[model samples]
Target: MTRPVATKVAFEDGWKAADTITLDETARYRRRMVMTSDNGVEFLLDLGEARLLRHGDGLVLDDGRVIEVHAAPEKLYRVAAQDPHHMLRLAWHLGNRHCPSQIMEDCMLIRRDHTLRAMLEGLGAAVTEIEAAFDPEGGAYGESHGQHGHHHGHHHD
Candidate 1:
């Protein structure tokens, strides 16, 4: 049998997905890849360009079936501060380090890093290790999936 191909993404709601694929933050960003649904159906994902797949987004298959995107739980650090101002300061520190962080009203979420954890602790930020889905802010240029378009083609280390 021929494999199904997913070439489009549907962000609108109300479409019942035929299957779901749970992926971590890294796996959710792709331009082309072979993916397997949660229930064991495999398909090819071929998009015009790499994009971040958010939870609830649907991968539209050639056969008209939608495969839902689910964000899988991952190890992360939940950083909080004594107040909103302090929280902003903590966020600044994370941003300065170019860390991918999910900024929230009360806290910030980032992937676990020993050095960063130590820095946050020294900065008086309350850092707690937790497991949750990470959806970081988009790139500086407003593009999702953290692809920073630099004139010099600089890459993130």
Candidate 2:
């Protein structure tokens, strides 16, 4: 069977996906991958380069089928600080440690780690354990192609 290559991403107005593909952050970035849908349909994810897929975005198959992407749930720590400055500092610390964190309006979300949790608590942050889909900042270069945005540059393979 010929595998379908997705050349476009649609945020809306696409055909309803017959099935969904739930993926974590690490597995979401890909140029080519063989994935099975929730309904057991096999398909190929062939893009221009390794790219991050977002929830609700439709993978436009060459055969006119659209596959929906879903962000898989993960264990995370929701860190909240007494003040905005403190929260910002915590974010900076996470960045310094090369940690992927999801920035929120009043809190920050990072993958749970005993050391990091202790550090956060030590810094006067209130850590709350939670399970949610992770969609962290993509860094300086990949920042443009954020959660729902598309990238147009070469990505290291």
Clashes of 1: 0
Model 1 deviation from the true structure expressed as Cα RMSD, one decimal place = 7.2
- TM-score, one value per model: 0.89, 0.86
Q: What is the C-alpha lDDT profile of model 1 across 1-157, one tens digit per residue?
A: 9899999988766889999999999999899999999999899999988888876778999999999988898999999899988898888899999999887767889999999999999999988989887878877675667443212221111
lDDT of each: 0.85, 0.78
In model 1, where do residues sit more than 4 Å from their true spots? 146-157
- In TM-score terms, candidate 1 sits at 0.89
Question: What does the lDDT read for residue 27 in candidate 1?
Answer: 97
Per-residue CA lDDT of candidate 2, range 48-131, in tens? 667678767788878888888887888888889999999989998999999988777778888999999998999999999988
